[model samples]
Target chain A: MTKKAICFTAGKLAELGKENIPDELLSGKGLVYSSPATLAYNSPGAEGYGVKRAGLAVPESVMLIVAPGCCGRNTSLISNMPGYKNRFFYLEMNENDLVTGKHLARIPEAVTEIVEFLKDKTPRVVMICITCVDALLGTDMERVTRKAEEALRQKGFDKTRVRPCYMYALTREGRRPPMVHVRQTLYSLLEPMQKDPRTVNIIGNFAPLAEGELQRYLTRAGVTHIRQIGTSESYEDFLKMASANFNIVTDPEVRAAAEDMNANLNIPYIELTRVHGIDRIAKQYSAFAAATGIEIDDTEEREEAWEAVDALKERYPDLTFNIGESSNCDPFELATSLVRYGFKVDEIYATLSPERFVYIKNLARLSPDTKVYCNMEPTMIYYDMSGSKADITIGKDAGYYCPDIPNIAWNTDIKPFGYQGVRDLMNSIASKLEEGRA
Target chain B: MRGLRKVLTPFAPDQSGAVSVLYSLGGLIVVIDAGGCTGNICGFDEPRWQGAKSAIFSAGLRDMDAILGRDELLVKKTIDAASRIDCKFIALVGTPVPATIATDYKALKRMMEKKTDLPILTIPANGMRLYDEGEAMAYRQLAEVLGEEGNENKEESETVIGQTPLTYGMDYKDVSLEQMKLLGNSKIIAASASGVSFAESMGLRYEAKAEPAMKYLTEDLKGKVLVCHDEVFGKTLRDNGVDLDIATFFTLHDSIAREGDRKISEEDDFTKMVLEGGYDTVVADEILRELIPDFKGKFIDAPCFAISGRH
Candidate 1:
């Protein structure tokens, strides 16, 4: 009569098919558990580069969170971090404001006041972050931000731009979730500029991608100026992102913004998904080389990545892993890659989407009995990690569940991509496992 | 400019307060929001969440769910979660979404009651109000729903109410459900402003004092001081010979309020008080020092997790 967390084996999931995936495995189907894995998804501002941090990705930009007091409550954690001081402001909506819809009117004045408060360090952009209350109200944020810009103009601060950053949790499952919309909002600041064929912008993560094979490949291909929002030193430098001839989209969340850039700024883009499988990484590079008409000799990088994988395999022949979604790599894809590397993946904590069923299908063929637990399932409250056979855990959430195990939280802001990611991740696992033995 | 806060982040809201009070109460606590509210509660506001596990959850309300007023769906979800978890009761904590939609908690409670055998307690705490109000509401609901009558003949035991980590930080003392149920027989010590409000509302005789703030009584002699925290903390200091005036961001009950004591709402109010009030020492969370950078005064760091999320 003891309680247990709900989970399904990879074989059972593949047998049932994506269409019949259990409601417990899929997101937005039940009461979401407040697990550490779901914290970034649930409260975007609490950890990582969620809507709050993502909205402020533009250099010299500040955010004005317009929501009920609750929505902005956890932002104090973000505000306390370095480089975030005096950046976050709030306009708390009371019950009267909710009913009267008068809080929207005050937003313009609030923006003006915030701009005035930071006189010497005036922001180039003020991102007005709105929440579920405004989402339910159907408030036209575009119009509100326009009014705020006009108010600033009248105050002789015409240079400061006002933009809307939707932190709407209600529209999370929609086509443009908060993360996607924030990217579009950030990229929308890019005005038409003279295109530089040599300059390619990395459009995805707010933090700069790790200096690895991708950057080296681009550098060797005669691309002199590679612009990423995180590397941009100033607001003026960030504006130069518009000058890129094309963009390299690293994250799927940034595709909408890349599409916007294509339509408006005339900057074409090529997407490179972060995967762990060494063959897939090489295949993606080959596709990149063909598309860009630049010869990519990835043989050395591929061999190095394989060497790292083999080294780890030799060290821990039957090493097991428990991967969570809060990490840089896709939990399913990472699990599949780990299984293919001749290692056992004990469990994967991630949401099951139909698009990711390919990984699950691959995992089913390799590791049929590997359990998949949706981090957001209500039954996760009873998650007893005593049953986990993982020798080591990866991602912050997996570490939280398995405190006794050696963990490598690969969820850093600086992303790891391509073959470098594969090699680095394998080496990190081996190092952590070795350290555990020591 | 009325609601604009350029100096400070928003303090703990009512939803966080409700969760703090009901967190260790062995109840299946559900915050009625899309997800962010529950995230704020678990991820930031509730310090107990770090090393412990609580049955706190989000209703996982979608835009369509709110727009369409899917009350039945919420009821079904609650019942489903209750069936899976081991809990003594179910508490529905409200946030901005329900407030915006004008959710009738009484009816939701009725619907949930019909579906499950466990007792249901709904706190209609819109995210608009501060944590003190939410804590008071939870205390009121807990007393009304669980307080047993005909306990006047039983031996009296004293229980501290409203000393949650949000207000008292690591020094928070939790009140159990067993203690809550026997409130009618217990002599209550209102440990905070919320507790005072709760005790006052229930027409119960109680002593309002914060035992944690008693440490400040032995501090070095000071000129006129401004104490900004829970009303009970200020009252406790003042009662113990501290020459201080209360300037609380939270509720300052008339009973605890002196002639000079004020209930401040915004950052400017605190700034105006510190700069213009001519006090020698300012006792508050040091995060508020950003507001009165020009004021040359002795500042005491009384970390209130509600104001500044420091432990």
Candidate 2:
């Protein structure tokens, strides 16, 4: 007997209610399949700005990953990249170290060795990345990092700061996941400085956000210095982020960090979610204008976004999509927005959460029969894409699954957001579809 | 500074090696980890995972699950997955989480066996050990659980053991389950350090030679050449008239070990060897060149996926 991939329609999911969501749809319920979509979530270091990359987001920083050899194996992919060269070091833990917790003792010496080894390229910060082994052992990393700092100080390198970042996959479902924790750890480095009204820091996203109306909107409202960690030139330049009046949080994962900033540095924050729907973008911008007392007339940008959508619609009037969670945009929101634009969505590959049920409910109203496949489900091993009628696929994982279909891996480190994101995505789809036809 | 690695990232661990062996063997391979270990194996370690689908999964053990030592839940999850997925057998590969908790693989295997009729192969690979050890363990477990007694009627074919992508890179040729079952009767070839270890452990009469390394045997060398890869690769090169010394991070069997042939575990060991060996030519993965940038030696490129993942 042939087994099939398990899938539920948006309507069926909406009817099931969030509390009654199937175990297969929600992650952490069963064994997780190593699908490409799940790789980003499963192995945080595999793709994008995971704990390893995010820890090094601070300018002039190097990381020392202290864990079992397996934890740091995938880091070679990141290490080989041009930007990450000479930045990553390792302190591999063994069985004896696991038992005695002696790796913690060796970290200070290891940190000193790494700093001495990288003499001329002396780092302003050293991030100590520990994995689940420490998470299980309940190792006091904060004290260990302080000890490392003191060791550096005693060695006449007092300027060097040491910090610990957790790569605890076991605590992924907990309140503070590794991603969320890393953001907090990075932002916590910012010391309180005199607030500048013109300066605003964009918190979240290790890579710079796409040049769009979001930055333009802030700049048009008399904002002079717009700082982002990705665009910061040096350690001193990164330190200037401490003077920002407020933070504009782009990702939800960074909200805890934003809260920390609010408490520690007295920097207020405004959260803007990355959405695909033009209406939602407009509403979010309007809300932003109202809260910050910054008038954002998004009429031109809104029309431009809709124009791009219409242009794509004209070229492929009955275009259908297969969306995956590996993209920048939420699969449910993107699916719902596409359906609202009179385009068909055949399938969505993503893990479901109760917080995302609102989008699923909205999607049910627009596209009831759209099948939702959990990318991490054990049954996804049998996922056969032959029956799908998707003309195009969005996201890297979707591209992997549907090789024949024209795909736009909109999962670049450079994020897409707001009105410009919608416009760029629409044009990208049209361009890719044209390329496919050619 | 015992495990401080400044030049190279850590190589693929035992769990990854174990998975690499059992990847295509018609089994539901489950890594007893909290997603990251499984992700590292599929995303980085296992080159075959790209564009290929396998039944490899993470047990998805949470903090409480590991803290409380929930073996029954893991067994239930495996049984549930096996019910839906078509597989000939089931394999449980261990990682740091299991190692930290001191997970009893024997107990877990016994628990799963009662619920499901499928044969269970348990590889207790702590993530601390290197890939070669894990591969040898997997090969040993496969032979113990699946190997059949000598058959009089069946035709004997030479089965290659431990020629996985982790060791052979692009030249990896898989040994199927049927071939693995005939280990007792068929002639065996130990393809790498792991193969040699497995062959010796099982007391199987086998030819110890790396067929892939035979390609490097023809390279013209001037002076003393230092070959750093799997031990058998170096041995194969030496047998075919290469005046070389073997320095392997993997295994160095007594049969393959010659004078000056060292078993290295750190970056400094390799650096010291290259500096002191006085070799005119060094043959290893290009990634190792980062360690000895000052060494003025002719380097011959030998891509070992386990060392550099260059395939």
Candidate 3:
């Protein structure tokens, strides 16, 4: 099983037709086989570090990752990442613990000791990140965390709280992915408070959004205080998240947490997906404005976004781009947008998510010759690039399959939202193409 | 709840450790569960995976396929992958879902044998066991399934098995220094990710029970200041005139840290002894050398996989 993307020409994909192409992503029919590409897909450069890496976003809060030593070994590398030193702890399980489930009993004491260990400052929360071991063992972490909290209180650390977050990879494709659940788990820390309509809390991204049009638009809409979990200066500032009048979920993963906030904290949220198309993004904003009674004039942003797109078209008029599924935006929709802009988009490498179907149908109608491929498919290793005409690739996974090709590892910890996202992507692609020429 | 983890990231399960045995070997390693098991191994647990070139895929067992036993699908996919790559063998590793559902691996192996001529070995990794057990099991299975029939002359293939990073950090260099001459003709099998000797190191640790390695170490060693890990020390150091009284052993695990009189509870214990005890020679992991501000002593860089965990 070579771990490369399955290479197929646009003509071949067109022949196969959209109806015949397997919906392996959302359908859950993952094509498993021997793999070398799996290595690249899971590499740190590819941002393959799971939710545990993202879950540690809360400032000053420590994570006690309970699993066997094997599971915790990688954290040593992660622990070495800036600011992670000593913030991550472990309560490992052995053969006896795995069978007798005795580790659960020791967790409270472990929490107690961890709390005591962090004497310099009383951490706001202790996130208990559990894995598939508990999924199989069926350990009720809620009850377990309740006991752990009691132990923390027993130790007289009244300022802190212990909460459970599931890292059950087995349940990743279930109702909510592990990253989504972790978002909810992190936000669940905020207790209900009186609404401050002037304040807006942004949930979803672990990294703070760069200063963009959105911040100015929010300010114009009378949003005086914009608090994002990643940008929150302190635990107290995070606690003040409950005071936000509404939540703006920049990612789908955090939408579940937004729903939880709406139910538990009485603060409603508007969900917006990051897209490259100026019109699609503008329409989404209009929908948000209609829903929330907030006027958003994205004319300047939209015009600048088109200028970048048109400039790219003028320079790389005959460019054939390779888009991929592993990036922040939907590869299918991104492909559709590129095709619409008259720049050749002949190849797309992405998993078949349900939302993909919307863009897939459109691409099939407009750009029927565009080839669709799954990165996880076993046959991807035999992807011959000889016939597939491609100049630049978009995502890391796509770049991985297309060796010797200029690729923008567009996936990042930062949120690239709306018209600014389009402008940024066009500039990045243009610079990369110029570098290739030089 | 029978066994749920609250805060702990899933430890390196047997499935991941099992992957280590075939690390450098040009073999197709497939974890039969879902994406997470494979992701956990390739992404986090196995440090050698980055910039690596090995065919390790997850069966991508969907909820329905898992609910209903679908070993045929896996067998078909394995054949397609093996046919594409030049793998020496195919290793099928298991996870929690297969064990809970009781997926028959033996039958799956038979089906796999029908499709490809390459040797197919199944590593029993149910996500329930630790890395040591999984690794030990992988070594045993590889020895039996992949071992070639040989003549009675054992010297021809003097292999030291049961070596891996799990027990020994990058400390094998220090450990090997003590017995360089002793293991000159011999080669380490699977201490860590070395591309040879797929057997495990625990065989040496538990050799006293029945194996001959301990007996071999006993007759050769004269009384001298020795520092070794706890796992192998208990068995090998128990030799006549070679007990813990003559040796200082360091171990992180409290349960197996003791051998007669000597016990090293913490890393500081090793630091204190090495500085003051004035030992003539030391046999431990090379990582300890970094802890000492400066060192002027005889030390063997031994790599033990068992004690390579966070305290």
TM-score for chain A, candidates 1 onward in order: 0.98, 0.99, 0.92
How well does chain B match by TM-score in each candidate?
Answer: 0.98, 0.97, 0.61
How should the candidates be ordered by lDDT, best one leading?
Answer: 2, 1, 3
The DockQ of each candidate is 0.79, 0.81, 0.24
Question: Residue A251 CA error for candidate 1 (Å)?
Answer: 0.7
Residue lDDT tens for model 3, A1-438: 454455454444445555665543323454453233343333211143456676778887888877654445456556656877667777766557766888889888888877776777767788887766677777899999999888888777787888887766566567976777888888988898888989998788888876798888888888899999878888888889999998998878788899999999999988888887788888998998898787899999999999999999998889899887667678877898888888778787766654456676677667777877777766664566665688988887677667778888887768568888999999999999899889
Q: After superposition, how far is residue A172 of candidate 1 from its true place, in Å?
A: 0.8
Clashing pairs in 2: none
What tens-digit string does per-residue lDDT give for candidate 3 at B24-126? 6667888886566676677655555545556777877755566667788778777876777667788888876676567788998999998888888888677
Pitting candidate 1 against candidate 3, the one with the higher DockQ is 1
For DockQ, the strongest prediction is 2
Tens digits of per-residue lDDT for model 2, B1-311: 78999989899899989999999988999999888898889988899998567899999889999999999999989999999999999999999999999999999999999999999999999899999899999999888898887653233788888899999887998889987887766788888988999989988788888899988765566698999999988888888888889999998999779898999998989999999989988989999998899889898889888778787
Better of 1 and 3 by TM-score: 1
- TM-scores for all predictions: 0.99, 0.98, 0.80
State the lDDT of candidate 2 residue by residue for A304-336, as single tens digits: 999999999998999999999998988998999
Candidate 3 wrong stretches, greater than 4 Å: A1-20, A23-27, A30-49, A384-388, B1-17, B44-52, B62-88, B95-104, B110-118, B126-136, B150-311
Q: Which 10 residues in a row give candidate 1 chain A its minimum summed lDDT?
A: A37-46
